[model samples]
Target chain A: MTINKELMKGSTVILILTLLDRKPMYGYEMSKEMEKSSSGVLTLKEGTLYPILHTLESDGMVESYWSSGEGERKRKYYQITKKGQGLLKEKQREWISFRTAVDQVLGGGPA
Target chain B: MTINKELMKGSTVILILTLLDRKPMYGYEMSKEMEKSSSGVLTLKEGTLYPILHTLESDGMVESYWSSGEGERKRKYYQITKKGQGLLKEKQREWISFRTAVDQVLGGGPA
Candidate 1:
């Protein structure tokens, strides 16, 4: 599925954090896993995911290290930082609350 | 609560459509109603809402008309066009599916 761009915007951090919290993975691997695990719901383009990964690293929400290997084998692997984990929890809670709020409105506001 | 910025970005269209679908509303009214209905989960600044509203109008998903009155009383009210209603249904479905997909990943993939 082509993820809605707008929803994808806000969900970037949580999704990254959620995936990284499982295990460290390189960008290409992360991209593939996002699609596979999500049952093809999220397909991350390199252009979009790279910048987000860089920003997350700079923000200290994630950290990356070059794998020790020859040039052809080397790749940057990202792991969620402690801060990222905390934010992930918060974002998850916020997501649930946000969804409920929208439902209330769609259901015609407060009962 | 201050919404997670990214979630707000993706949710912009649906929120606007859902509210305007109920009845015609001016920008200010829509902004206020967004906060009220979402329990303050989403707060749209005029800068942000204006651009999206304009985009929706340009896309023919919605239409706006000025109230026939004095300058102070005149305000442009937006209503979701038929195309918007169809889009709304599609977006709502995408949102639910997206949420479930994320949950599947967060739960550590297939059981």
Candidate 2:
């Protein structure tokens, strides 16, 4: 399904953090995993993913390190920090609450 | 619960459209109804509400008319257009799909 960009704006951060919480992943790997996990419903474009990763790193929500991969190619991998885990919990709660609020207004889900 | 403003951004339009879909309403009435329907979770602040209503009016999704209420006060009431109804259906579908996608990534809810 074609998702609205506006709707995807705030969600991108949550998706990235959820993936990182599972395991440390390089940028490309995270994007691929997100696509796979969502069954291709959510694809983090290279243009969008890098900036979010950079911001998350700067905010101390995640930390990154350079590591050599299968081809001896250095890749930057991001791991969720303690702070990121805390924030992720909060965002997840907020997501559920927000979804409930929207569903209430739309009148189509559990009340 | 305090929602992230970023998450609220894309949803405000949908909420407004949903309310207007039910019936014509002045700005204040719509805000109040939204708060009530969402069980006080979604409050549309005056600062944020008017601009959206005005934009929706200009976009032809909704049309506005001045109506005199009690105490001889004139309020600008908005009613959804045919085009607006069409958009509302599309947005509602998108919302459900987007929520499902988020749920899938979060590892919660029905698949």
Candidate 3:
């Protein structure tokens, strides 16, 4: 199924926060994890993902640091901050409310 | 709950179509119904709602006409077009897929 670009755009911050909530990750690793986790249903492009990362960082929702893991070249890894976590919780709530509202109207209701 | 403006922006079209799918509605009526039905989780301002309606009208997903019913003054009412219905189905599928993918990562799974 074709993913709605608009919806994806709206959920970008939450998606990034959700992934980073587990552990810190670099951009490529994060995108790969998202693809795998979504079972290829949501493949995020680097172009689409990086700018958003930068925005999140600037917004103080996320922070970045150099990571030089064993046998791997140094890369910038992103992690959600305490502020980010709170924002993530807020976002999650909003998503749930929006989903419930939409489902109520779209699902088994008077038609 | 604080509704994410970004997320709300993304789902505006879907929400409007879902309501219009039930029956034709005017601007004020649509906003009121959305607030009432969402249990006030979403309170769409007329300014925010109208621009979206205009965009949808331009996209041909919906059409508008002047309606005068009973004692009410003439008002512009909107209804979903065939294209809009097709789009609604696509949006529904996309929302489901997105929600499922999100649930997988956010739920009690490998962390």
The positional error of residue B94 in candidate 2, measured at the CA in angstroms, is: 0.3
TM-score, chain A, candidate 3: 0.90
lDDT against the true structure, each candidate: 0.84, 0.87, 0.82
What's the true lDDT of residue B52 in model 2?
91
Candidate 2 is graded, for docking, as: acceptable
The digit string of per-residue lDDT tens for model 2 on A27-97 reads: 99888888888877778899999999999999999999999667788889899999999999999998999
**lDDT of candidate 3?**
0.82
Q: Which digits, one per residue and each the tens of the lDDT, describe model 2 over residues B10-66? A: 888889988888888899888788888888887898899999989988999999999
Interface RMSD, every prediction, one decimal place: 3.0, 4.8, 2.2
DockQ of 3: 0.50
Best by lDDT: 2
Per residue, candidate 3 scores C-alpha lDDT tens digits across B1-111 of 546667676677778888898988999998998887777777678999999899999999999999867997999999999999999888887778877876776662436
Ten-residue region with minimum lDDT total, candidate 1 chain B = B102-111
Off by over 4 Å in 2: A108-111, B108-111
**TM-scores, one per candidate:** 0.83, 0.90, 0.84
TM-score of chain B of 3: 0.89
Q: Considering summed lDDT, which 10 consecutive residues are worst modelled in model 2 chain A? A: A102-111
